[model samples]
Target: MSAPESAPPTRPPAPELRGAPSPRLHNEDLAPRRDAAPWRTWDLFCWWMSAWHSLGSYTFAIGLLVLGLTGWQVVVALVLGIAVLLWGCNLTGVAGQRAGVPFPVFARLSFGVFGANVPALLRAVVGVAWYGIQTYLASLAVMTMTLKVWPASQSLTAPQFLGMSALGWICFLVLWTLQLAVLHRGMEAVRKLSDVAGPVLWIAIAALAVWVLARAGWSVDWNYREGPALDTAGTVSAIVSGAFLTVAFLAGPMLNFADFSRNSPDARSIRRGNGLGLLVNGTAFVLVSVVIALASAEVHGQAVTDPVELVQDIDSVTLLLLATVSIAGSAVGINIILNFVSPAYDFANVAPSRISFRTGGVITAVVALVVMPWRLYSSPVMVNYFIGGVGALIGPVFGIVVADYYLLRRGRIDVDDLYSDSPTGRYWYRRGTNPNAIAALLVAGTITLLVAFLPALSALAAYSWLVGTVIGGGAYLLAERVHPSGSLLPEPAAVPAQLPTQR
Candidate 1:
């Protein structure tokens, strides 16, 4: 459905309460929506489909299979893990739909106006990291195709810069520019691209799977028995770890889900979309990955975890070119939807008056380049320690937001106070900071990080997201009970209702 006509813009409160126009808490970009959200339930489903059907997600599925679980066991883990993720997404999605605000703005309800920046910046930094990593991954496909068509291009590998070959840098920059172009067109362009890309990539993947099966035969082993065999107890632990990793894989998007959810017209749409996108679509994709991996091992004498490599094995240049393009397109689709958009909104929220959405996105792109994520991608140790650690931190913020919205506030948010700096404003706590929330985040995040990084505690690292979320949420509940933040408390029964705008 078309969005309704934009309502007349509402001005921020007077300077006495809102301070100078220079530091105004709310701006047009961050404000409650004046027009109806246009996204339907199917749009949300396609959104997840686009996000999930990436080389990185496929690699992650391969990682789960490598854990020695049977195909059915892996499916069980994925279903359970996705259900947990869906629950979290639905909770935040409801809040976003009801408030008609982005994730960072919605954070103000719990984190206070100024304090909201903490979580916003944390999430933004993570996005920048993932953005670079994904861009690098996408570029690899271009590099592979380049070398395939022009073997002479292989000479570009001499004297590598920042651990990347000249050809790799060329491909990375090319894909990076392409992503920026798409992002510049804004959300409508993104929605349209996702709607097309998801289905196209699905067809490509299905074709590849069928070809692999036809060549390798259907007798491929479905169990991961090539490595050391695990006993029943070990097998069960591996399955559970597979489930935990599934949640970790999508943890970043799940936290900033409000970015998309706010654009959704209703909570039911978000729920239905997540169910199909994550549960059903995710399962089917996992099955395809398993079939392709088993076939690759049977045909190539080794399991090809990387889809690009598997495609490179194809003798037909036409098929190889098509597969490479599909991987590149899928990478771009996911990187934009998951990595680029979150930080754009987040950095804009950092100083809405100073940073426009486009500028924030540009800033994110530059920072992604500065991180030189190719180095991170090259090292498995760095991947586990650094990228994994950052993902674990998201759990704490997620817990705090969910707890405050559902438990403390009981699903009621005062939209006006979310922008107000007045002492009387419900959300204006202690010069715009909520110490209680910050405390919970730090405590929970620190412990999770330790578990994720420390060698001695590595056994718990895989489940850090789950552990941190529970601890952070429980801590917030306890802290609020002892030192209540009246801002999030429910209003008196006699007070006139001014419910947050549904659209």
Candidate 2:
């Protein structure tokens, strides 16, 4: 291709928010795409599919059986969960798709230019932790497969250092380095890899389910728990709790969907992608996972949550190699989307002028290294309290942003002012922070934290994500309505027929 146009037209493009003047907030990566944003409905559908068909998601369905609900009941919850995710993604995504900015940049509308970093940092912390955990899990898959083939190689695991064996470090670093190499090539490479790996991972999952079912003589025990069944009220409660658990699993991605959706050509295309991807593909994955978990338990005496372990137990070198490769690829695929990319944009938003997207991603990787995710993942107290504590803190921010943009601002964004720290700029409310936004965030976050931790509220723990969103959103509406913030601009006479040009 020829070298790009010198710069965008002096008049900003329609169907986008572009051309911020401030150096403190403007950069090539964070700026609206001057070139075509080429992703379409198919691309987004593949993106969601790629994000879902991974080692983590495969295990997710099996773990829900601990809820003591039947397979079909679990399926219903999964559907509701994905539906909730779809609703959120569409609401948040249309803003980004139309505005042509990542979540952090667009969020300035609600959170203020500098205060936007509050949400960014919150999301980045979560993304970095999970990024490390997923990489470690993938490395374990590769190492386990190797040890299975060559029993003598078990010697490499003798010395434990920094909570991982020597062989474990080697595998982890190798996977880590390879993933960075792919990311270094940029998002296009990430997209291509997902397009290929996502379907391959699901296909392998289907094969695994078929093989396990055949081995079990085509019969499945719905009572996967090996205990007395839950009563009617308990069963009803479990289904509701299980549904929210599914939502929480995808909440990190759903919260900042604009990271991906900003590349879409139009908002309608995003809606199409979300509909097909989350509704159809998500349902299929949950149903298949349920079938596989049930059959595997009957055949192997326990439900196999980890696909890698199940393939290894089949005792075929060929199946082991295929499953291992697929798991590694799909795990990396989802990691980049779910855990890596959002944080990259988020960290860059902290100082767009100083940090490029690649630099931000490296920063995330460094933090992930220090997070020592294996330790984080292993400690029950840590997982239950620390992660949940931090998670509760962030959930309210999503609601705050959505409420500010769609309801308060009436879906209009002043593109140039998003970059302006100048007190006179339209978005420079109260020296670059919206106090009302902060109040709602704190009030709702505290309640969500209580629901997650207090034993008296244990029954409500599973619903924390939903609770945070609703309470946070409702609080914002009430706060802004009762005490009007004059910082908000009046809505336009009508929605613009074309994108408004930026100076």
Which candidate gets the maximum TM-score versus the true structure?
A: 2
Residue-level error in angstroms, candidate 1, position 346: 0.9
Ten consecutive residues with minimal summed lDDT in candidate 2? 494-503
TM for every model, in the order presented, reads 0.91, 0.92
Looking at candidate 1, what is the lDDT of residue 129? 90
Backbone collision count in every prediction? 0, 0
Worst 10 residues of 1 by lDDT: 494-503
Model 2 over residues 1-503: C-alpha lDDT tens digits?
12223442232353343344687776777876445435667777888888998889988877887787777788887898888888888888877876778888887877788888888888888888889989999998999888877788899999999999988998899888887777777777777777677677788878888988998899987655735689998888988898888888888888888877777766777788888789988999888888888888887887888887677776788888887887888889899989998888898998888998888888888888888988988888887787668777666887888887777777767676777778887667787877777788889999999998999998899999889988888898898898766666654322332322211
Across 172-233, the per-residue lDDT of candidate 1 in tens digits comes to 99999999888877777788888889889999999999988887976577664446778999
Model 1 TM-score, all chains together: 0.91
Q: After superposing candidate 2 on the true structure, give the runs of residues whose Cα lies further than 4 Å from its correct spot.
A: 1-20, 223-226, 491-503
